[model samples]
Target: METSRKPVLYSYFRSSCSWRVRIALALKGVAYDQAPVNLVKDGGQQLSSEFQSVNPMQQVPALKIDGITLSQSLAIIEYLEETRPDPRILPQDPKKRAQVRMISDHIASGIQPLQNLAVLQQMGEKKMEWAQRCISRGFKALEQTLQETAGRYCVGDEVSMADLCLVPQVYNAERYKVDLAPYPTIRRINKALLELEEFKTSHPSRQPDTPPELKA
Candidate 1:
């Protein structure tokens, strides 16, 4: 972990989960090289034999760091936190840290899976409605949770892992055409998060693999 070598991240731009890791890396000031794994083209490059060898789950947002390949965005982030603690993304206070994990889990597990690519494709004709409804339900709960937990960020005055998780989900919600007016707290938090350089730089449109037309 103390080498001069930069980590390599295999990721896709539109993937919220991938975005989460990207934000974490940026916030930690961990320089990385991106290996764009286009999830859409060629029936998902992530599913290819080579990529699957790197990740049996066949997922993007896999990080090659310190001679280890780590999969799953949140897990990769936790590993980063363990190795690179400066400017920590998790909170120092025990209770606030729990709250951060709570909010992060709610979105990461509760909300994300219901709207992931497989689910969307399975929905077929009802995909739009399914995605919109799923996002609204998740956002409603998230809005309520943040009202009690938020100040400047998801857990408190300082940005935390929860904020990293929230930003990408909000992006996915917007892409799925969910109405944001129902969740003002989420919108406010997202707007503030977007203003920060790390979040802005880690944005999907800014990624190396982002489709040209989708680039902002």
Candidate 2:
């Protein structure tokens, strides 16, 4: 549990889930090394026996830290928040913390999974339509919720786990061509979050694995 070595993150360039953890690590000032996992190359390097040993689920954004390996983006983030409590990502107030969790789950569980790579791959020619529909529906609900909870960030003024979740989901929405015109609050908050150095550094376009054409 105690070591001098930096954490190792297994990530894919364009994965929203990986981007979330990347943001968390950046915000926490955790200088970790990345092990790029090409989710597309060679029929998904995540499915390879080597990466599968790192995570049986073959998911991106797995973290090796504190003498153990952890998978699932939210789980990895919570571990970081718990272990490194400086500049906290969760709110101190109980109700506000619940709201952050609600918003995070709203995107992470209710939205992103429906439009992820695996699901889209199964949809074939209909993938674009499917991703847009899912994102639009989720954003509709999220915009309403943000109207109540948002100030400068997703919850009040301070950045929380919800902000981390929101930015990447918004990026995915844009990639799928979901119109942001209907969701002013979502667009405004996403814009603010993107301006932050942590979010910028953690962006998929800026990652080590990002292709030359995709670099930003």
| Candidate of highest lDDT | 2
Candidate 1: regions farther than 4 A off: none
lDDT of 1 by residue, 56-131 (tens): 9998889999988999888898898989998998888889889998998999899999999988999999999999
For candidate 1, the per-residue lDDT at 130 reads: 97
**Stretches > 4 Å off in candidate 2:** none
The lDDT values for all models are: 0.90, 0.93
Whole-model lDDT, candidate 2?
0.93
Give candidate 1's root-mean-square deviation (CA, Å). Answer: 1.0
TM-scores for every candidate against the unseen true structure:
0.97, 0.98
Clashing pairs in 1: none
TM-score of 2: 0.98
- The TM-score that candidate 1 achieves is 0.97
